[model samples]
Target: MSASTPIARSKSAALARILDNVPKGYHRYTCGTVAARKAEALAQKFHTLYGIGCSPAQRLIRKGKGLANVVLVMHWPVDAEKVEWLLLATDGKGLETETLRDVGDKQRLKWLGYELARHTNRAKVMWTWRRTKEEMTELHALIAMQANQHNTAAISETLERIARQPGFRGVRTQSWALCEAALQRGYDGPLPHLYFVQKTNHGERLALD
Candidate 1:
């Protein structure tokens, strides 16, 4: 039987071990608006330290846990639609966490870990579709490299770029729409400012001037 939660020294570190097994395709959508820069920054740190492409979408861990906990907010890579936000957490053990948001027909976290499957509750039906690996790879390369080169003014150009992809079929889901919005939301800081905080010992975001 899997433990109810993680029991690793660092939740982020433990999660890195499970990301490869989450069953997501190439990570194309990364980087978010000013509101999400903190998460993106932390996601880069996780990638650097653990090699798993993860970002914190929502970091609302209540106060008081004798253990280190990290909530990684992200979308399932396999789902090209990006309909829902997948919240993954880590603990003192392995990758054990509860999904924060599930707004789609299928719950794809079965690959995260057994503990997560049990804890993942609620699923709101949303857009569903299938995408090719080539599409995903192209999007990732285009968006990631020019992440800071988009804004409300360049929305047309950005959309055009995505639409011009080899097999671009167009956005089919609200999740994909939201993901596009984030891409064009523009960068708030010169560089991403990662935030690592606990309710008890909450810390300010690390933004370079």
Candidate 2:
């Protein structure tokens, strides 16, 4: 087929749009349709490239496809946050990593007709199926805090950033709503900046690094 063919041009345009949708500057797990390969084959690819026991987990990517879901071609070991942080801290576009940053070799090969192993710094699955009120409340807090992170720069800028994040519109929470209201009103009192407020043991003293 010639490069100028209609199908070729259409594919090129579609691929370009996919790349554009990808968050820039962050390392991405190049995902493919779940029907593309067997679990063993997918895991083997990562093992071959990264090292022994370096199996990547499958991630469901929900976007663009009307009723269809997508899964990873071969998940990369590093998560977007780790990649961004490593790049920023090292001041380089790429960074090195030791083998299996999180676990040993793949085990329990299969209990469900598939083996999905991952030792990546990937975030917890979003499980966008649904959320309870409490879960939604937590999401709002997380959103507000994420917006105010140093990476976010300013409040107004963070608001804009929050607006751009997907899967948040469905969440409804009074606390998050309050935070949003305060943020919109320019009331920047105290923000929920900590990821988890660790509760120390009763007799244990907190240690400062």
Candidate 3:
């Protein structure tokens, strides 16, 4: 089914809801101050990586078996209407940057294989002896280019830029720049020097820098 369809949207939303509650000790990647559209985009990414059919019980089984990594996309309420703090949950044992890279790579390879097999060698009849390998080599380069766009540095820069956009407010935290602002309401410790931008002087703000 197309991702744009209503049923597909519902399934994606359902999958995201299930992920809201996950096993303890999962790592978090916070994409702070997410609008509904951006949250949906992130949820679609998770849905693409892990199929929407996964259940909490099955997630536990997969984690136990070491056959699959548990992943979740979650959002918490923000003062702004129709926006939230989007966070990603994954196996906490590894670095968050590496986990994101690994997930992106696996998805790319899976799509590449499917496309090469489907387009160049339909019916599995081996239309050409070496066509599949040749196509794969060509496609791999394109995948590499796409992969570069999502590296740690690039993604961090993107998130930083997003944080500075109008409407986001609150003080930055020590753990990570994006998450601290979101968690400041409950955090009792000292806050950092960064803060998000507000377009106008009309809204309920957690704090001002």
Candidate 4:
């Protein structure tokens, strides 16, 4: 499906209207004395990269992801090259400044791949949870049972199986660990850091600083 379909158009139009009404070059708001700047930096970066103006409504949608309250609809050109260009531009700060050793790069790429895979699996798990909650519970219990029987290998195998199950798509073990670690550390917002850890043969962990 096209990214800028009718629904996307409506969302974009709403965001555009919000932006137009705001004072030029002023992108901050106050709910109380608690005032915070809008995501002007991110918006400006996006605009510079994609040649599209971003409005407060768009910023709200992005910020809402942290709150887990609102559904965001972002539109971009359907072409793969353009999509890559936008992503590359938006992601440049992380990829360029981050110092990743060879091993760390491999680990990070593995984690990224797993994350992508896990998104697909999550859909299945969600569908199963909705349609047959009891079955889903039992499935998880069975997997946990298998995981408990063995050591690290068993744990990894169990997780992989669960991930490969129909509807349980997306990244495997290390990715989940990274996500859990981030969440536990109070990363309730966008992924601000672009670092990953790699374990060495000497049982030491190296940070992709």
Candidate 5:
């Protein structure tokens, strides 16, 4: 495919975002046994050429399809927020990694599956299936704060800060979605920027392998 192709452009955009968010020397882990092996295999394939290494965990399935719903465990270096990825470098070969930085465009799509892995990064996972109670409570709080005409920047900042706290991570993402859903139900209140909100289309389902 040509470099200017649409798919190439999409991959380039996605790859840029992934590379930017994924810290140097940090790798990702895919949760679950089967998903983990797939991630490991992908990482092993390009480990010799690229230093990126993703590892897998020995857990069972949780949600989504195949690797889609497998929670991603990111392993961060000290001083960085921790996350995990699958496709681990073999023992003693810590240098070998599963990165897309230097991989070709064709090969890039293969690793895109990693994106489906359950991720804590707000940019990756938009809706949180866990912690619904906390999320709902926070959602109402944010709406109330917005009604009080809090500074949009402060409101956004608060959302970010709160989302990072234990038991509240991804609350911001879900908040936006919930607010949107509320609006659809004929509620009115000051709301944060609604640009990032996403919703599931009716009848859509994850393709099972």
Candidate 6:
């Protein structure tokens, strides 16, 4: 047998073992449909990559398809305060225009991803193209502050910088409702999972793979 075959089998067996030992009375949360599907996909990826089961206990909760929301019940401990702190920290800084201009570079993406991963244990991230113009501007300023303390550029400088970037130049408003949603629940991280989702949609999932 090939070396990978045994490793794959071992991972599958470990998942089975984890499922068999699921605990009783696990609480389920409505994470929305897209979030739920994405979460499951992430869980599967984690199993394949690390052979780690997401939950130690299983509880049969309602399962629905074609629904806009996906729900899950996990038995792991959640640190709400920690999540909030992380989210606030991430939202406080916006990427510099120079950084955004270089976003097309492979090295930059990897560097940013590495920086983000150090703050959380999550393996994937998602990015949504759904922010209003005002919201996007505010987010950019916040990210800028987080990225640098001496970015004393005037509004015109910032606007000019943003205007020079091709992808974001015309996107006067980008949707950040997802970020707001995550913040509502006190989640904090650099949104690596959102980045993963964007790459997936662009057929660049292989980059992450």
Q: What C-alpha lDDT, on a 0 to 100 scale, does residue 23 get in candidate 4?
A: 23
**For model 2, what is the error of residue 77's alpha carbon versus the real structure, in angstroms, after optimal superposition?**
9.5
Point out the worst 10-residue segment of candidate 1 by lDDT.
200-209
Q: What is the lDDT of candidate 6?
A: 0.25
Higher-TM-score candidate among 4 and 6?
Answer: 4
TM-score on alpha carbons, each prediction: 0.20, 0.21, 0.27, 0.20, 0.25, 0.18
Encode model 4's per-residue lDDT on 1-209: one tens digit a residue: 11111111222232222223222322221111111232223334434433233344654564445311111112222232211111211211223322322211222221111211112344542110111334445545554554355344444454445434222212123335433443443334332222222221111111110
- Each model's total of backbone clashes: 7, 1, 0, 8, 26, 27
In model 2, the Cα lDDT at residue 123 comes to 69
Residue runs of model 4 more than 4 Å from their true location after superposition: 1-37, 49-86, 89-105, 109-142, 145-209
lDDT of 2 at 84: 8
Instruction: Please give the distance, in angstroms, between residue 148's alpha carbon in candidate 5 and its true position after superposition.
Output: 8.3
Model 4 clash pairs are 114-171, 117-170, 117-171, 118-170, 118-171, 121-168, 121-169, 124-167
Compared with the true structure, all predictions reach lDDT values of 0.32, 0.28, 0.34, 0.28, 0.33, 0.25
Q: What is the C-alpha RMSD of each candidate to the true structure, in Å?
A: 17.9, 20.1, 20.7, 20.8, 15.7, 19.9
> Which predicted model would earn the best TM-score?
3
Q: What digit string (tens of lDDT, one per residue) describes model 6 on residues 26-98? A: 1111111123324335434533442222222211111122111111212111221111000000111121211
- Runs in model 3 deviating more than 4 A are 1-23, 50-53, 65-82, 88-209
lDDT, residue 209, candidate 1: 12
**Position 203, candidate 5: lDDT:** 19
Which lDDT tens digits does candidate 3 get at residues 60-174? 7766765444443333233334443323355534233432422123222111112111123355321101123444344344334434554444333433543343221111112
Higher-scoring candidate on TM-score, 1 or 5: 5
Scored against the true structure, residue 171 in model 3 reaches a CA lDDT of 16
Model 2 Cα lDDT, one tens digit per residue, 1-209: 11110111121222222222222212222323222224334434433432213112211121122211121122122121111000101012122442112111233111111222322226632111113445455555655565556333454444443333222112212234545654665555454431221221112111111
1 or 2: which has the higher lDDT?
A: 1
